[model samples]
Target chain A: MTPPETETETASGEGGETRTLYGSPEELPEPAREALGDLLLVLADTKRVLGIHYADWILGSPTLEAGIACSAMAQDEWGHGRILYAMLDDFGMDPERLEHERGPSEYRSSELLDEPTDSWPELLALNLLLDTALSVQIEAMRESRLEPLHHKVSKILDEERYHFEHARGWTARMASTDRGREATGEPFREAWRACLRWFGSEEDELASGLAAEGIVDAAPGELRRRWVMRVAPSVAEVEPHLVQETEDGWGSAVDPDWEGWEPRTRRLRDAPGPDDEAILSRVRGDRNRSLLGE
Target chain B: MSDRLVQIERSRPRGEGTMDWSGVAAATRGDRPDLDVPQWDEPAADLAEEARRALYEVPDPEYPISLVDLGLIYDVTADDASGRVEVTMTFTATACPCIDFIRWDVRERIREIPGVSEVSVETVWDPPWTADRITDRGRRLLNRAGVSV
Candidate 1:
């Protein structure tokens, strides 16, 4: 079979299939429009950074098919990045400048994008959990009033569902083998910790505003609950040894300082660092260039 | 007294982000006192072609194909005097992560083939590779497997 149209061979696979532009946005809700800029940036950052992570596995994968699968997903993330950037530009922001020139701190992506995956299980968890989380938001975006963003999300969500299925299925298979079960269980715990840091607290204005205006349809915290319900069943089947968290896992999204919790914003603008360029350069330098081509 | 002027720093593998030959060489060959180290007996003319030939000799080791046909070989060049060969290649993508081991495996195999000199294996990104870049042999194999390139 020919490789999927979305896949290609490159160091990063960041240069995947070219994005087709949907029409520009018309009049939008003021709050939604304002939140759209950072929302798109966050999505774009997830694509770009995740693409880098996928590239890191080149040549190091256990098998050829594994490599091909990762490359395909990496390209998908790159394509997703482009789609978000296009939507941003359609909404009146310059995607080219925003993407290539922005700093890491300026990125609105969740913390899951910042951390690197050291093993296949970690990568798998990111796909199953993190991407699944993003997919939840995308489902809501399917009905988004913003035309360009809505159509793009609808297309992307379809593709992303497949990605989630692959990961979930793999997680199921991993449960069969003792080594797979153990190897994955520990990493899943660590990944869950990382996931906890993903969606921001309930009081974040941007998240609240986006949800209030029906831009994202739901806040990340609300989306996370759904995400858990969606993934936990499949994942727990494989690794019954896994520990489950209660609703207190993330606590209430509406609470500003929900007891023993700290508020983390999903907005790239709130990340603890310089802008995208600074982050990208740092990641680039640390990036084991040869690894990218693997 | 040393009569030969060697630019110690420059000649000492000063490049950043690339592997250090000092360590690799030591680990691979230094401890093995009995291992036969290949030597160059001829002048380094047509070094690129020689390196290309050497690289072509390396089978995928994992897959049932040669690196050239598998599309793992990208660019190959040689420095006649230094006997140094710089090869650029790529795997399927960042996700096909086993490439590091493949690259190192290829490098080791190539280096052991009575190589005239050094080997620099790098991963280049410009002019991205596609299935179309695969050789006729690769295409035939793909066809046999019902895979369209």
Candidate 2:
């Protein structure tokens, strides 16, 4: 859906003459700068973890072609992670520390990617739902006031097009069979909850501030709605508990369980974030650390 | 920079009713003011030409075709005085497994050009690549290699 346009006055000079964009990260004002940092961390960290999971399936997917797609998608995620991390460098964050030194506790990734997919159908649900969740959030930045994102965001979105298609195709294929639908049910529910919940609530200041400052075109709730519209139809048949169709078309089947949700980490207060240091170890290239050279 | 916050332009106004894909399939998406603007800070045309010519000789790691023919070299800037060369390029795919290899190749090849002291290879994704970006030379070469255009 086309989002409501922010007025030029709030988004630009006092006269509201024209919308002027931040020429670079250097020009960002105080809180918007910090908010963009938080936003990028969430995106880059999620991509990093998602890439690791995709890498896990490269050799074991149901088909050789699926395996190849996994390899490509894994590379795409890592490549995107690298780009986002580089962008964070503008905020005085060190890429090396973020990628290598940080543990699972620091991750802003949705809990859905916190664990490995036990089955191919589960992975497809993640690809269809979680990936779209990330893509729509990125889409919110398509006209970011942060000028640097014009290129960076568009580039990342280009690579993700194939990811969405891959997910949509596989989910449709898997949804075709009763057995497949049964298998995908649990995973779809997991992703459905994660995508909606992780987007944070309308009350979340950081998500809304990013919009108020024009760093993102939409706030958290709108992005979640867009994500639901994108994935609801794909998961509807298999996951009755997670998708609803109304006269307005697609909407979440249930209210996201926002209890215990922490807006800062974008995780629940009670649940432990992914305790998998092993995945972090691989992403940091721990085994091959000896081989890394200047 | 002013501390005052400015609201951003919503990419699409409500009632436009189109999916906000940002014209993902379109050639270019939005403005980029910070990154290198080829036209604004161009190096000597002759030097840039030399850099372009050199890049044309560098083949993609997996393909025999030159980077120029593949439409991967977006812009080449050469400073005859400063001996600096910047090649702004993109890959056939973002996850081109050979991205690093290609970057190294572009850097090393451009470095070989006379008068170049520093080489920077930057990648951009706006105006995403399609078969349409392929040069006539790229088409002929790919056709010769038994790959359909």
Chain B TM, per prediction:
0.61, 0.68
Query: In DockQ terms, which candidate is top?
Result: 2
lDDT of 2 by residue, B12-40 (tens): 12213223333321212122121111232
Q: Name the 10 consecutive residues with the lowest summed lDDT in model 2 chain A.
A: A1-10
Interface CA RMSD of each prediction in angstroms: 17.1, 8.8
Candidate 2 lDDT, tens digit per residue, A1-294? 222232222254577655656655667766777878887888888888889888889999988999999998999998888778877777889776787777777888777777766789878877888888888989888878776675567767888999999998888888789998989888777777777887889998878988987789888889888888888877776776687887887988799988788887777776555556657778777776666544
The digit string of per-residue lDDT tens for model 1 on A89-123 reads 55677765665556666555555556556788877
DockQ-derived CAPRI band for the predicted complex in model 2: incorrect
In terms of lDDT, which candidate is strongest?
2
Q: What lDDT is reached at residue A138 by model 2?
A: 91
Clashing pairs in 2: A10-B7, A11-B6, A11-B7, B27-B127, B83-B117
Report the alpha-carbon TM-score of model 1 versus the true structure: 0.52
